[model samples]
Target: MSRSTSHSFSRSRLAALAVACAAVSGTLATLPAHPAAAADVAIHDIQGATRISPLTGQQVTGVTGVVTGVRTYGSSRGFWFQDTRPDADPATSEGVFVFTSSTPTVKAGDAVTVSATVSEYVPGGASSGNQSLTELTKPTVTVNSSGNPVPVTTVSAASVPSAYAPQGDPAANGSVNKLPLRPRAYALDYYESLEGQNVRVGSSRVVTASDAYGELWVTVKPHENRTKRGGTRYASYEDQNGGRLQIQSLGALDDFPAADVGDVLTGATEGPLDFNQYGGYTLVARELGDLRQSGVERETTRAQKSGELAVATYNVENLDPSDATFDAHAAAIVDHLRSPDIVSLEEIQDNNGAKNDGTVAADATMRKLIDAIVAAGGPRYDWRSIDPENNKDGGEPGGNIRQVFLFNPDRVSFTDRPGGDATTPVGVTSAHGKAALTASPGRVAPGDAAWANSRKPLAGEFTFRGKSVFVIANHFASKGGDQGLTSQYQPPARSSETQRHAQATVVNAFAKDVLKAQPDADVITLGDINDFEFSGTTQRLEAGGGLWSAIKSLPKHERYTYDYQGNSQVLDQILISPSVRAKKAFAYDSVHINSEFHDQISDHDPQVLRFRP
Candidate 1:
């Protein structure tokens, strides 16, 4: 995150934000004594039955409601108030957020008449593709009375629609912003209808663990695409978990209990429905339910048999020699992952990680990890990799993070050919119907623009039990600039994928070249692909039957190595050539040691595959 992170917004929207900022610059002020009369409307009618408000950008004078919730904390200080009398239509929400942008004089249960301008304030800005939040901005309030009864709508499992989102109007360019709310049909529309309303959810299962930001995710549909590890698996774009809801407290997070996945929040969890950028719609709870521990535990994969060759991929999250997680990572590799014959470690930083000094060597880092693995009762692993140019790879500055191969010398012998360097391109050479690497432990197309500012794939050749095997470890471009799933742009655009697709194309071409050299070539390409197996990147890599992601072999519910915002999905993968997949004896397991746990050594769970070569 750069300090100068900026977004380009339309002049009109920029002016609106400027006016909003100026409205509540210092303190709260009451309504004007003499004001021009304007058309009065109910809160639901103001909210309308569409994604966008019907009275957007209009000045409304008379609005009466009871303050259901007040948020005096944070920069966006305001209160949620609801009309005591709701309209007959269930599609329109009865509540709205008063964007004071500062501390308010009113409290919950205070009945008041508000004169304010209706504004559609997009949470993360319109350019972020987030849906606009209907708010009463630059308001003038006159208190009528106190201790008024506020309505609390109970939202049970039956209330949430089975459908996730609406099919956007094709004319509107697949944006549901202009679509009418279908409260009984679509979940997004249903939540949009209840935006800012006081609601309560019955006992729910915690899907995402509590984070440092004092937030947790719970699902009303507890059994929806659930994983054995007690998480909701995000299978595909069309099959997303609809019941997932983010939960936050109005009060201090210190009072909120820490919880893991599968933990239960017993009883009713009441809050005001609000839409934000972090995770789309959220429940800002005023009273939190008591947490019931679920007793979740880490998982270990079965060790490889004597005749089998085990290969694993793990993203250590920028590990260096001095990090405290070395012991834990070593143990995870040795005990949980069961000490595979070869491990592809991503994000292995240079010695003295992130230091600006021109020290690009990572021998110290590798030695430290190897020593820890040995201490943890694992093999003395020999390693091979190319040190990336300083800051050339897209990782922490000066860290020079790159993919590395840690192989047990006792189990496998590296086919070390000459002339392998950081800037050299590794190629395939065919002789006597056998395929061999031009350079051992070499980079694939180091000078190609596809790998610009990204980790280049490291290709290594080894002989396992007199059978030659080629492995290409890749850590492709990340998904930083892509639009999120809840974006106003339906089926949000993945802008960062252009580079990943190019990278995948390059690696796939290289693998195809090897397969062309020998049709039965045993080639394995694996690492942090940074995209799902169902995505175009994966398809590009699996093009022409060059390689197949072994993760697909597992059951749909068990096909996740990373969890992002409670969606158990895949990022790391181990792909095998058709020759290896053709073998009858092949097993894959994603060791669940990290992602699900709050205290994680790495954000990714290590995946291992064993096969007779």
Candidate 2:
């Protein structure tokens, strides 16, 4: 006999007496009713036509499924269950989350019947514009059997759509939120249809390396706008790669393996579909896949040719004397980047290195790095910089980071002139038919509002091969207060871009002043602009046809100096005046090292530009 909490059935067959009793009525009735009448409800029935549950606020009974996954510790204490027999409709998912608010009593692979009240839970509460999750709250589980087989659904190229998102509704503030669900026509719809389902992925390439948050982004199709390093190239706002997906491990942090770009995730990985704040739709995997290294190594640029001057830009990421990354950073400049003739360094801290005892001199800090470079078999390079007023520069608290210039005295000579300080603004002038700085190694427009609380531009004059080449180093305003793509705002606002635009205008005007002074002057303006090549900030810097970004000289896929969220984008740039731009004998390379690797000394990869003046 089989019995439920509300009903019971007989095991023995009925005798002829029961049959004879119904014979007079011309109908033969069995001892018990049909088994389906007691268990007609399915998981898909509760998860109805829309994102919200159709039977919400109504208590349902006899929902039967096999438990597929269980979360024991987190606040979202729940177990995922899928119906033994799925529906034919591809739009409706057969799996649903059963929230118990406590440890689940039944383990995975157990066939259990549940009775619960359906509810929709939003992750960020009511005000957040995030999608709602359908769940069964206040659930009571009755284990029917054990060791049941759990079904795994394979997600492949054909399963997802080629489009990233559906066309937004013009009436709904340009949001795709109201678009009808076409599961096979868009990536967002495809993920939404499988919400809370158990899925498996086959061999895939790692797009983004494993981050500190224990997440890895991968792409099933490796040939779609892929970079040489295995990362998907985000061509523009319109070409978002739909094959990208994130793999989040639900196991121990230490058990999660470290991976780099171009690595492959082999074997089968099964997990439950979860939508969270970090990435749109993530697969929280209980079993992680194996990582296979692609034998991809960091690149070393060719050494400078005879009579060619090599200039580089590096953002050391708040290099302070107290930090121990100096030696590794120097080796990158010496061995990997080939020790350029002149390098512009940003984020150099004060002598005391964040001690903040009113100390503004960075002589000791500069000497330490210069010594480390020589010890690493690099050239004996001389440096010039002006210390900022105490705590005026914005960076790590008390760090007072600023830009500095490093040059090989044997290859180039710095033109020394008087009257340069931390507060004075420098102007461009014509001297001996070339562009000259009013104060050599001086700050440009220090009093301008665009430079307030920011690292001011440093201009220096140097002579290479009997020709004067002017270089301007800059560290602009950061990209802060920018909303993420998954935020409530449809096309999230880039709030930091306004200040960066103003900062670019200032730099552009200064470049124009230099170009106006000498039309054929060899001027290179380069540093960590903290913006992308295609961004408006770069366009503004290149406006008036005065300066051009050297990063544009390389192919679009090879222009990135930084990686974020699996997308390799450009942040560091080298812009040159028209004189240098008009020349045919110029080359640039964005050295690949720090950004794609886990063991990085800095967060940015340095860019090297070789040219003859």
Candidate 3:
């Protein structure tokens, strides 16, 4: 028998029995004799072990016991072991296993013989605080009167968790006949009212579109005419009145190539009642009911012309810099982000530099940012970024900081802008020099850095609500406690203000030029401009450029986005042109999502405005 706290077998037979005993015990041990003898032991009776441990360098043996429970931990790649053997007391059988490999094959309730050398834990000698089992050998074992291994079967549809089952797959979608019907079971309020019900819903009508990860997305309008099936409410997409159904796919517009605006699809309806991932934004699709194609509605420009739009901007402070930062929290980083329909982020480090340990290059930074966004919430955002300035100096490790834009492809279609050798001139000369600015069909470049270091403007045009909207997302110079002649702080040459003011001038000039190009254009300029509403920099845009400030109209208590020294200031803003704001139906609201330090998730808060023009 394997060496144990107690005894049962002799030395000669002990070697062979040692394997069985070792396998039975959940631990390992080493013998005081030859190493070859220890290696030769083959376990026979696998499941009935009382104790198991591993051996040391010396000739030793281990203890083994039947496993009671197994649980997954950490990254879902490992497991822990609990004991439940005949001779083993249930009280001390709470065994914690240290798998031989990072990923183990064994699972709970398996009967096996483990050969190991066991010893008491050596405090902090690297292997956590558990006894050391250097080698875990699986020997021949018997379970439930069977000599061969027990067959492990994958859980079938009947055994699958209710959360992921029938009617969930793409073809069936989230249809009701696929879910277990029970009245008010598990807090399924909407579906509970129709427990044990069967209903027929008309084909769903396509509504607004969304695109994420370069994939196309379409929202379906639920059918409104109601019929009762087993007491459950059933309707078709055409009947939804104004409500919509959202669906996302990983292919481009040409993939399915079947769906079009006003297309009618018929399918069963079910409950995704708890779906609220997008919060206020319609980016996330909650399953209204299963939508199967019944027939097609007449094809028309189903794109409704609503003069209302809600635009939100935020500065996701220095998103990811070096590889070290990216690797450390890649999963957590992806989990917390909320993808707005349109997000204007600032301070996204582009090139690695001395400060960032220079790991993610510009191209790499862009790739990582894209991956991060998708991992957070997939099939929602289709990326359209301005190409980085290849000629600019590469900072720290990642590269230079380059501002970028990630748009929901389904809703907005884009037109790239022009590019040129335009550079943000350095020092005093930059303020006076003719700032090079260009507009192309679908491109932005390194030369754009003249606006902000690692933070430049990303301008693009996309169609929304049957109208083209121009978006200029930028990060401006920071407010570093310096006092300039003007409250907006435009310092003279050689001062920090020199670079700051030059950057602001570049952004302002671009805004003016773009507006002049489309006299009646719907223009939205948003980002961390770093200038308060009361500041002259913004005032100049309001007075001279005729831009409408979104924050100025909000109540004083809700105007601020960030607070410093107990005083709140609206440093970030959204400025719309008079033509867009003048749409009477375009009543706007500015919300301070991060107005309070306690309520803030990041250092900077996100500002949102809803206006239809």
Best by TM-score: 1
Q: Please, what is the whole-model Cα lDDT of each candidate in the order they appear?
A: 0.83, 0.76, 0.37
Please rank every candidate by lDDT, starting with the best: 1, 2, 3
Off by over 4 Å in 1: 1-27, 30-39
TM-score of each: 0.92, 0.84, 0.40
- Can you write out model 2's per-residue Cα lDDT over 49-87, one digit (the tens) per residue? 455667877888888888888766545566788887888
- Count clashes in each candidate, considering only residues at least 3 apart in sequence or on different chains: 0, 0, 107
User: Which residue pairs in candidate 1 collide?
Assistant: none
Cα lDDT tens digits for candidate 3, 143-170: 2211232221111122212221112223
1 versus 2: better lDDT goes to: 1
Best by lDDT: 1
lDDT tens digits, residue span 107-190, model 1: 888877887888787776667778878888888887777898778988767888888888767887778898888889988888
Ranking by TM-score: 1, 2, 3
Q: What stretches of model 2 exceed 4 Å from their correct place?
A: 1-64, 72-77, 84-89, 96-106, 112-144, 167-172, 351-361, 389-392, 486-489
